[model samples]
Target: MSDRRMSNAITRPRRGMALEVVLLMLVMFSVIVLAGLSAVTTISRTSNADYHGARATYAAEGGADDVMSQLDAAMQDGIISGEDLANIQSPVVSGYRMTQATRTTGVPVSRTITSGPFSGLYSLNQPIDIEVTARDTSGNRATAVLSVNAQTIPLFQFGVFYEGDLEIHPGATMNFAGWVHTNGNLYLSSDDVRFQSNLTTPDSVFWQRKDSNNRLYGVHINNAAGTAVALRFDSRSLSDPLFKTRSQQDFDGRLMSRAHGVKPLKLPLPSNTPAVTLVEPRVAGDNSMVQDVKMAWKADWHITLDASVFTAYTAADSNTMKANFCTFLTQERSAGLALPSAAMCARIFKPRLDAFYEGREDNRVGSTLAIIRPDLIDIHLDTLRLWSDSAPAARAPRIIYINVINDNVADTRRDFVAVRLRQGAQLPRSRVAADTGGLTIATARPVYVLGNFNTIVWRPAAIIADAITFLSQPPNPNMDARTSWPSATRCTGSSAGWCDVNQQAADMNTARSTNVNAAILAGHSATPNDFMRVGGSQPYGGGLENFPRFLENWSGATHHYTGSLVSMFTSRYALGLWGSGVGGQYYSPPTRQWSFDVNFRFPERLPPGTPSVGTVLQTAFRPLY
Candidate 1:
C-alpha cells in the first residue's frame, strides 16, 4: 500500500510462491539431517556386532581350556573313571555355569577288553568324547569338545609271565592278588606295589601300591645264587591249590619239572595252615637269602610269599632251593597255579619248545618267556617300558592298533629313544628317528591283521600315518620360486621358495612350480594354487584350510598359485578341515586360535512366513523420490 504507486519492484511477494519456497528449504534441511543420523546409526550397530562376536569367541575359547585341564588331571591319575566324568557334567567357575556331554563313535567298550585274550597285541580299546558348554546370565554362551582314547594293561588277564631280566624301574609298582612266576632276575627299585595271590579277598584285584613315606618294601625272591631271569604270575583267582601253601623252594622244583616235561613232585601241606608269612622261608646259614623288595601297594592285607635272598635266580643244582623257587613261580602262574616258594619260580622260562603247554606254544617266545595273555596293541610307550623291564620282557613284534587323534605328527611328537625288540626280530638302534617310520593307530579292535611276527598292521582308509610323519617337516617349499601378489617379497629362512606375503593375491603358476604344490598334489588331489593348507592326523589339526597360513586363488584360473602367508596363530602345520570340500580350496583370514563355531542349516530355501535374520537377497535397485 505504501508503494501503491504501481512500483513493479516491491510486488509484496506472491503468497503461494513464498509458501512453496519455505517448504522446499525445509525439506532439503531435513534430508541432510536424516542422512547424518543413518550413517551414525550404521557405524554404532556395526561396532556393537563386532564387539559381541569377539566376546562370544573368547568365551568359547575359555571353555576349551577348561576341558583340556580336566583331561590332564584324569591322565595323571590313571583312567578317567565314571565319577570323574560326573564332575564334568556340571562345572561352575566364577559366576558362569558349565554343562558337559559325551558321545562315542567307532567301537564300543566291551570288545576292546575281550578282543585277543591270548594275543600279545590284544588291545583293550576305549575312546571317550567330552563336550563342554558354558553360559552366563547375561545371554552369553560358549561350547568346547574333546576326545580321548585309552588302552588298559592286560596285566589282570594272564598272571605275570616273564623270561628275561626283569627290571622294575624305581617308580614302578605291580599289585596282583593272583599267583606270579618268573625265570629271570627280578630287580626292584623303590617300593610302590604289592604281589598277592588270594582271590578270597575283594582286595585281591590287582592293585598298585605307593610308599609315599620311606618304608622297607619289595618282593622276597628265594632263588639260587645267580640263575634267575624272568617273572610270571597266575591269571586265575588265588584259591587254586597250586597257589596254596607250598614253600618257595617247592614252587621252584615244580617249575623245573614243568619246563622240562618232567612230572612235578606233589608236596604235602600242614593240616592247619599257620598264619602265612610274606617272607621267603630262610634256611639257616644259606647264602641264598630272599631279596627284599619294598611294597608300593600300601594295602593292609596278609598273605604269605617265601622269596629267595640272592638278587639273581640262576642256581644250577636241580634241587637247589633258589632254582626250585624260580621254576615254581614260572610254571604255576602260566597254568594258573602258584609257586609256594621263590625257588620253584626260578628257571621257569626255558627256551625248550617241548616245555611249552599245548596251545600255549604261541604264547611262549624264545626261552622260558611266555607272552602275556589278552592280546594288547602296544600303544603307550610307557606300558612297554613297564613290561619290557620285567622278567623275560620281550618286546616281540605285535600289532599296535590306535585311533588317529590328530594329523600333524609334530604336535605331540617326541623322539623316542631305546626301542627293545620282541623274540624273533632285531632291535633297531636306540633312537627312533623322527618323521621316519609310520606310526600305527588302531580304530577297531585288533580285527584286521597288521603283522604276523608282529601283532597287527592295519592302515587307515582316508588318512595314513605314513603321510602324517612324512609331512611333519617342511615339504619342498619352492623357496626360489617367484610369485605375484599385492606387495610382498620372497620367503626368508628355511621356509623359503614361497613369497613373503603382505596383503596380496599370489599367482597360481608360481604355486604349481614349488615343492609345496608337488607335495600336496602328490596326495593325488586337485591342486589349489593360491594357498597351501596342511594338517592331517591325531595330535595335529585336521583339513587343509585349517592350516595356519596358506595361499588361495579367488580368481577362476586353470593352474595358478600364490605366495606363502603365515597365520602367526595356529599350529605349525596348516589344517584344511573347515570350508567346503575335503581340502579347503577356499581361503579366508587366518585363525589366530581355536574359535567359535558357526552353524549352517540345510535346504537353502527359507520356511514360509519367516523373516530372515542374517541373509542376502537379490532384487532390482530403485531410488526413492
Candidate 2:
C-alpha cells in the first residue's frame, strides 16, 4: 500500500512542472513579435522626414535661379519698373513650398553710395539680393540666399551700318546724320566737306550754371590726342541762394539757328590762345548706398586753370582723335558729373575687373582710381565722298569724329598726354592738338576732339585713278549709280586703306597708360557728385554720322535734353561730357546734392510699427499635477 502512494505523488509533481514551462514559452514569443513591429514603425517615420527635407532644399535652390533669370530678362528689355516687382511670384516645387523677397533699384530705398562718380552710381545700382525658405508637410525645412548685379546697354541700334570703308570722292556731296566707324584712315580734299550745326542748340528748354560747389559737374570731352577735357558752367551764376534747386530744375535752355550761315556764339579765351591748365578740385560726396541722402561738398580746392600755363609743351594739329563722354547711372539718378568728388564712388587703388574696364595690367599705377587700361583699341573713320566737281564747297560731306581720352597721373603737377607721333603720316595729330591743348582736362575723363585730317597729294594721275575706283563702287553696292566730278590738281579719300591706321592706334594705346602711382589718390575732404548729362552734337563731331539719331532731335538744350533714352547710351563710353545752357537759358546747379548712410538695424523683437509672426506647434497638453 505505501509503494503505490509514492508513485502517485511523483507523477502529480511532474505534470505541474510541464504546465509552467509551456506558459513561459508563450510569453517569450509575444515579446519578440512586439519588438519587430516597433522597429519597422521607427524606420518609416525617419525615411519620410528625410525625403521631405531633400525636397525643401531643392525648392529653395529653384527660387534663387528664378530670380536670376528674371533679372537677366529685365536687362534685355531695358525697362525694369515697379510693375515688375509686383508681378513676382513664389515658386512651388514637388513635395515642397517656397517664398521669395526681392529688392530692386530705382525704388525709394534708404541706402546711398557716395564715391567715384555719383552719376555713374545709377549704372552700378542694378544689384539685387534674394533669400528663400522652404518647408513641407513632413515638417522638413531648408533655406538659401543669392545676390546678383547687372547692366543694360544697347549693343545694336537700328538703321546703323558699319560699311566696310567710306570714301568721299573729291567734289562729291552727301548729307546724312549718321556715324561712320572704320579701322582705317580719314582723308579730306582742300576745303571739300563742311560740318553743319543743328538749329535748335542752346535753346530755351534746358540749361544750367556751374558753381564752385559743383565744379566737377559740367561738360566733359575726350579726344584722340589722348586727352580728357571738362567744360563747366559759370559757377558764380548759380549761387543766388534764392531757390532750392531740384536735380531737374537746375539746367540751361537750348539755342536755335534757323540759317546755316549764322555762326554760334563763341567764347574766346582771355588771352590770344593761352596755355592749357590743369585743376585738381577737391571733389567730395557720399555713395555708400545707392539711395542714401547725404550732402557732398568740395571745400578749399576750387581754383582756376589757366590753359596758357600748361600748354607750353603742347603741339597743334587737326588729326587728334575724340570720343563721346560717358557716365554710369541708375534709372532714378543721373551721374553727369565732370570732375566729381572723391566720395562719389568707391576709390579703388588696384586694377580689379569688378570696378573698372581693364587695360594693360602691368603699366597701371593701381591707385585710388583704377586707371583705365585698354589692351585693344578701336577707331572709326567716316567715308569720304568725292562728287563730280561742280563747285568745290557746294558738295559737303559729313564727318564723324570720335576721341579717346585718358588721364595720366604721372603728370599730376602738369597737364597734357605726350603722344609721340609717327614721322610721316598723312593725317597730322600735331595740328589738331594745337587747338585742343588749351582745353581743360579732368583727371580721367574723355573729351570729343572734333576736326578734319586734311592732305594734298601732288600725284595727280594716281589720285584721279583711286577716285574713279571709289566713286564707281556703287552707293548701295546693288545699285550702279555714278556721279560726275570736277578735275583738280589733288584728290582726297577718307578710306581705311589710305593711311597707317594701325600706327595711329598704337600711339593712342601708349598714351593712355600711366606710370604714376599716387595721381589717383582720393581727396580726404572732397564732396560727392551732383546730377548731370553727357554727349552733345558739334559741327566737327561726326554729328549726323556717328550720332544722327541724337543730333536730329537735339535743340542744343542742357546735355540731358534728349531724354533718358539718349542718356542711357552715352553713359557707357570711356569719357562723356555734359554742358550747361541750351538755347541761351541756364540750368541751375544743385546746391544740396546729398547722400545718406545705409543704416542696417537687426530686429530687436522687430520695430513697433511692424507685426511679426513665425511657425509654431499647433497645440500643447495640460495635465493635472
Candidate 3:
C-alpha cells in the first residue's frame, strides 16, 4: 500500500509541468502575429505616397499645357504688349492646383546666323519662358517649364518666295541676296550665278533637270559682278557634303554658312475664290447684267467715253483694229445705255485673257460715256493721281481693289479682270510727299504694266496681280498707241484731235538704263503648254528665265531694277517667245541688274498691302521635380 501512494504523487507533478510548457508557446505566437500586422500597415502607407507623387507629375504636365494655351491666346488677341510679362493662374483639376509665371526677352542678334526659314531669332520679339507649379492635396508638388516664340512674318523679307517650282536658269550672270523659299522643287542652273543668302524649301533642291535626264549646269557663289568664278557647285545630290559644308575648299551649294531643310510654310490668303483682296469699292451687277465704275465716287475728278465715238472710228478702221477696240464693249444700246454684249460676257467669263487695257482719259474727246463692265476697268494713274506730295490722307487713295466680276457669278471667267496701264504712261510722283504711307494695287485679273511704272520716285509700292507682263517699246514708234486702234480716214477725224497725234511715245532710249523699283507678285507658267508661246511657227516661250514678259526688242541694253519677286499661283497666260539679235522677232534679252530693296527689312517701310504671317513655335520644354 505504501509503494502505490508514492507513484500517484509523481504523476501529479508531471501534469503541472505540461501546462507550463503550453502557456510559453501561446505567448510566442501572439508576438509574431503583432509584428506581421505592423509591417503590412507600413507598406500600405508607402504605396499611397508614391501614387500621390505620380498624380502630381501628371497635374504639372496639364498645368504647363494650360499655361501655354493661355499665352498663345493672349498673344493672338493682342493682349500681351512688349515688356509686359505677367503671372497667370490655371484652373484646378481633380483636386490639384497650379500657378504659372511668364517672362519674355528679345532674341540676341547674331550676324553669322542672320536669317532662315525655320530660324525665329530674326523676329522682333524673342523667346517666352513659362514656369508652372502643380500641388496635390497632400502637399506633394511637381513643376514644368516651357518656351514659346511668336513671330510676325513679313512677306518681302524673302528675296523670292514661290508657291510653285523656282527655276533660276539665267543665261547671263546673276547675283541674288536675301532669304529664298519655295513650296515646290528648286531648279538651279546657269553658267555664272551667285546666291549670297540662305535658301530653303520643303521640297528637294535640284542642281539639274529631273525631267531632262539629270542635266547639270554650274553655279557660282557671292560673285555679284561675275568677275571671279569662285566656289562652284555642279553636284545634283542633296546629301552631298558640299550642301552642308561652308569651307572654300568644298563647293558651297547653299552659298550661305547655314542652310537646312524645313517644314512647309503656309501663307493665308484673304479669300479662297479670288485668292486676294484690296480696299473696298462700289459695284452693281448680277449673273447677266453687270456695271462697274472706276473712281466714280471720288469727288476729286471724273473721266468718261461714249460708245458712239468708238463705233464711228470702227466704221472707217481696219478689221483687226475694230475687233481689238470692241473686244469687251458692245455696239448695241440697251435702255438708252450701252449694254455689255453676250460676246463680252463669253470672253470675260473665259478662264483667262491674252491682255486687257483701259485708257485713263477719253480718247474720243467730244463723246460723253457712262458704261463700265466688271471684266474691264481703266487704271488711270495719271487721272486718279495716286501720287501727290501735298495730297491729304483722306484725298489720296491707299488701297485699290478691282473685282472683275460680281461675286454671285460661279463661272471662273466672270472673275477675270484685266488692268492694263496706258501705253507709254508714267506713274504719278511722290516727291517731297508729307504722307509716306505706301500704295498697294491688287487685282484678280492679269495686269500689264505698259511702260516705265513707278520709275520717278523710290516710293514704297506693291503690285498683286494674277499675271504680270512688261511690254517692250512698240514696233512702230509712229503708231498712235502700243495697242491696235481704228485708223482715221480724214486728218481731222474728231474735234478733240484724239487721232491727230499717236499716243505711243518714241521708243525708249536703248542706251539709258530702265529702272523698275517695286514689289512684284505674279503667277508662274506651270506646264510647258501654259507657257506664253509666240503666235507663229517655231513657238518658244522665253520660259521662267524671261518671267517679265516683253514685246519689244531689247538687244544690247541694260535694265536696272530693285524689288522682291514672288510667285504664288500658276500663270494664266504663258510668257511670249523671244529671238536673238537686234530688232529680232518678239524682244531681245537685256543685262539684268536686279537687287533686293533693303528698305523692306523695316516694318515701317513695308508696303500697304503686305500680308501678316503668324506662327507659334515651341522652342523649349523641361520638367522640374
Q: Give the number of the best model, judged by lDDT.
A: 3
Q: Who is ahead in TM-score, 1 or 3?
A: 3
What C-alpha lDDT values do all the predictions have? Answer: 0.26, 0.24, 0.49
Rank candidates by lDDT, best first: 3, 1, 2
C-alpha lDDT of residue 283 in model 1 = 28
Best by TM-score: 3
lDDT tens digits, residue span 1-625, model 2: 6988989988999999998888888888888888877877778777876777666777787776776566444433333445555666776676667777766534323222232111112222345555667777766788776655433211111011111111221122222121212111111221122212111211111122111111222232222232333222221234322211311132211111111111111111111211111111222432221111111111111112222322222332111211111121111111321222223211100011111122212122332333332211111111112220222232221111112234334642223221111110011111122221010112212221111111121000000000000001111221111122111101233321112122121111111100100000000100112123233322121111222111111122111111000111121222212221122111111111111111101221111111110010101111111
Clashing pairs counted in every model = 148, 146, 7
As for lDDT, the candidate ahead, 2 or 3, is 3
* lDDT, candidate 3, 199-236, per-residue tens: 66756665644224333345654433323344334323
- Report how far residue 309 has shifted in candidate 1, in Å: 9.7
Scored against the true structure, residue 562 in model 3 reaches a CA lDDT of 71
Across 1-625, the per-residue lDDT of candidate 1 in tens digits comes to 5566566544546766798899999999999899989989999988876665456545555655565466445433223445555665445556566666744345634222322112222233446665666566665665655555544322212123222222222222333322232222222322433433311111111111111112234533333343332323321223334433232343333222122221111001111221111111222432211111001011111112222211123442224533333332211122222222332223221111111011111112223333211111112222232332342213211122122112223321111111111111111111122311211221211111101111122111111111111101111332121121111122234331222221122121122211111001001111222111232222212222222223332222112111111110121111122232223232322212221111001111111111110000111121111
Deviation (Å) of 47 in candidate 3: 12
User: What lDDT does candidate 1 reach at residue 492?
Assistant: 34
Please estimate how well model 3 matches the true structure, expressed as its whole-model Cα lDDT.
0.49
What local lDDT score does residue 223 receive in model 1, on the 0 to 100 scale?
34
